[model samples]
Target: MRRIITVEEHFDFPDSQTIPEQTEPENDAHVNPKGNDPALVTTLLANFDQKLAYMDQYGISLQVLSDPNAVASTITDKQKAVASAQRTNDHLAQKIAQYPGRFAGLAVLPLIDPEAAAEELHRSVTELGFKGALIGGVPFGHFLDEPQYLPIFEAAEKLEVPIYLHPGMPSKAQRELLYESPSYSDSLAGMLGSAGWGWHAEQGVQMIRLIAAGIFDRFPNLHLVSGHWGEMVPNFLERLDEFIGKIPTPLERKFSDYYRQNVFVTASGMFTKPQMQLAVTEMGADHVLWAEDFPFLRRKQQVTDFLEAADLTDKQKDQIAFQNSQKLFGLAK
Candidate 1:
């Protein structure tokens, strides 16, 4: 098996321990509502021993760690948010130090303070050796393309690290509007809001908003990563192109060109071979990276087996599994 590097894997901060473990649905289930196995959540929330053991068993060489959910994105007060982010970044730096070779990290920035966030990004990449930052979507109902967030994009471009835009929990109105079905209860609705359906829609829209706002044209070197198969964006490439032609924008290139150049999508535990085929065809193989979405979509054996059985040639498979991530994040083989 080729050495694999999984980027979307998560671990919680020590502060999360103060919060009690969440109750899952009453029905005995294998994977919990958040797409985590209860047993794996225990392991994920615990120290790194189980993770290392699992990685050793599965041939995963490196894992880029970030929090399962972000603290800074939710906090509105700039001082509080920046303080929280610095603490988180410092904690993450220590974790990576414990097992530097087997681990790297993506820092969590205080979106409320883009200038501070940029400084932290520089410290994370240059001082702490973090690969990039992972942002949970939309802070204070504000999207990334908004002018206030320009510093974050500029910092990412300057630092040469991708911003992994992971999904955050959506607002109640947004959830109710999009995911309220007749049969499901509040729990299932909340699940859909986070992982099942809403995440893909939200992140995909966020990507489109950046393109429409011409953020790519303004910060041409900025790179962003979206998990869960480009939040289903590649599948809509033709339609996006069609719409881009109709709308006027400051961007010199079509939306698809910006997408193809500036965005990198990951499988992020959605290991379906067909989805991989579609993404590779639309976005190109080099723009796709592989991740297990660990602890949440915790199925390493299944993921490894699926990749091995995938129809792509060995080299292409390598690119999806590790080579592309290696190139993007500057990981060594």
Candidate 2:
């Protein structure tokens, strides 16, 4: 089996009082049925031993862990958010230290205050030895394309670390407008709004917003990691480029060009050949990373089986499995 480095793997701070109510056990089941397993949540919270065993069982060499709850992003109070983020990062850093070669960390930032978030990101990379920051969904109801969030992106570019853009639950207005339906149960609507469909759609829109706002133009070297096969963006890049060209904008490059240049995508729990082929075709093997979205989707055999059965050359498979991640995250070989 090829060495594997999964980047989208998640963990959470133990006794994290800041976890959003929506992420509580009862509601989480509705949002993501995969998370209904209490054992999964236990593993996500602090069961490092089980995580390591699972990795060993599946031949995974390393996992870059981040907070799945995205507590910092959901906390409304600035002070609380900042404190919670620091505490969470410190907790994760300690955990990574415990398992030396088996794990790396991604910082969770308090994006409520952009400047403070930037400072925390710098501290996380320099002091805590984290690989990068992971921003979960639309923080503070902002799409991250706004000027207020530029500091976080600027910090990432300056630090030469990629930011992982993980999906978050949609906001109230979004849910009411796009996901609510009298024809279906709330659970179905909740699922549809989240991991089922809306999550990917919203993430794709956010990426486009960043490009349209000239974020990449400003920070030309900024790197972003998007999971779930570019959040469904890569599949529609050609159409986006074609239509976006007709709209007048000051973008320095085509929509597709920005995506190709500044983004690295991961196969986070998406093991199908067609999506993998499309991602490799659109983003190139060098720009693709491997991930399992662990604890959420524990089908380790499916991931390994699909990867081994993939049609790509050995080198390309290696790149997706570990080489790309090592190069991007500066992981030790």
Candidate 3:
């Protein structure tokens, strides 16, 4: 059974270290990698507070967050890195506990090392009682699909916690490949372009690797969710199946089967009706959930449009809003 889940969201650290203001030129090849301008974030959080209060008029619950400043450079080493991540999550968990009605929390993880991430996951869930982890779109130096990070996936499998892949500026190597001229063009790719594309491409690529590499097959219960209706799953299911079937040799199982069993996606930034229908048809109503990019103050249109657009049964709508999340958080049946 699916229930309602409204994910109140916030972003990880932004492009450069300048919080709330731009010190240098916006150009110069994107100094602040994450694009979360601090001054902007502060103003937005205030707006988020107002919006959260306003949502009550419409009967929505806000799932709050204390995401780590995932700007890789900011959180550099051991003492400053892991401990700060834990402290932030611990604080957010405390906040959520205070307003149990309007809250559930996601941990912003520092995935510098696999063991470090494993330790933090345990602490966030067992001690501080976080709902799950939110990883930036790409790990600092590696893509989520890279085989080097299997131990991290193994840990999530053991913990039975979901990880949300929020967007971030892409790694240097990634930006170089997609655009014709990194020297002339920008990684920002017009501000929000590459981050959006990266999330979509990265999720699809990683999910394929997880399925193809036999990670999901090995850890059947490991729950993974990404932002933007899984980027491409909604529209590309048939093509994925067809390609896999046509080239089925090394892969042990059908491509469609893995998606049906292992993946979940959120309505965090996607606000289109066509996309909503495609997501429901491919991923199933139960597999899709809602997320409000809280501190960004993205706007109310997504909230209203998603509620109206999804081809959800009443039970499914309930799940997308609340219960689906409950299950992911170990809070539901």
Candidate 4:
């Protein structure tokens, strides 16, 4: 079997205490402030040994780790946000140094201050030797294409690092408008707005906003990645392209062109063959990555079974499983 290199794996920041509390739990396990999931992803204190053991057991040769949530995104205090991001990133850099081959890191950015975020991104890539930066949807519900964030985009393009766009719970206004319910229970509302359905929808919308705002056109070298088969974007590309074709937009190419050139999608724990086939058909084998989503749906054997059962040729399977990440992240030079 080919070595598996997974990028969407997450680990909690070891120095989380330095940062102000930011993330609100979207699940029952986290309803208590002190509670944590032991499954490798959302631990309050990261357990490197357990993670390494799991990887060894499951044959994951490399996992690119990032903070489970946007720790800096919800913190309103600028100083605290910056401190949190810096501390978190430094901690991750240490972990990667400790296990350089087994683990890689994606920097946490203080997006509230875009200029500072740009500086931090450069530092992480140049100084810490990180693979890239991971931005969780938006900082405090603002989209990435806003002018304040242009510097961060420009910096990422200049730095040549991929931006892994992960999901954050929607803003209160957004939740109230689309996901809230007077009749349904709060648990149901949370489910609808988060992992069950709305989280991917929110991520898909954010990518669309970036496309519509011409961020891709402005930063031609910018690369983006999203999990869960691009949050349903690939399936809907034709419709999106139809609309873009009709608009008097600034995009230098059609919507699908951006996807083909700049976007990569990951499995992110959904290991069904049909979905993988659709992703490969739309994005090509090189643009699809393999992920387990970890802890949230921590079932490695299921993924193993699905991949073994998949109809893709050996070359295609090798590309999605490891080779694509190796090239995109420059893991093999």
Off by over 4 Å in 4: 14-45
User: What are the Cα lDDT values of the candidates?
Assistant: 0.79, 0.85, 0.62, 0.79
Candidate 1 C-alpha error for residue 45, in Å: 3.4
Total clashing pairs for each candidate: 0, 0, 23, 0
Highest lDDT: give the candidate number: 2
Best candidate, TM-score: 2
Model 4 lDDT at residue 291:
87
* Model 2 lDDT per residue over 1-333, tens place: 678889999886743566553321223336643466867666555788889989999888999998856667666678888888898888888878889899999988887789999999999999999989898777756799999999999999999999999887777567768987999988888888888887788888888899889999999999999999999899889998999899888987898999998899998888888999999999999999999888777877876777888999999988988999998998999
lDDT tens per residue, model 4, 194-310: 777777898998888888888888988899888988998899999999977986876788989988889999999888778888999999998988888665567676656677668
Q: What is the lDDT of residue 232 in candidate 4?
A: 84
TM-score, cand. 2 vs. native? 0.94
> Cα miss at 39, model 1 (Å)?
6.2
- Mind giving the per-residue lDDT tens digits that candidate 1 earns over 97-198? 887689888988877788888888898899888899998766667888889889888989988899998876666678778767788777777667766777
For model 3, the superposed segments whose C-alpha errors exceed 4 Å read: 1-4, 11-40, 46-51, 64-76, 180-188, 192-196, 248-250, 301-305, 309-311
lDDT of 3 by residue, 202-286 (tens): 5567566666677666677887776677767657667877887886455666777777667788776567777777777888878
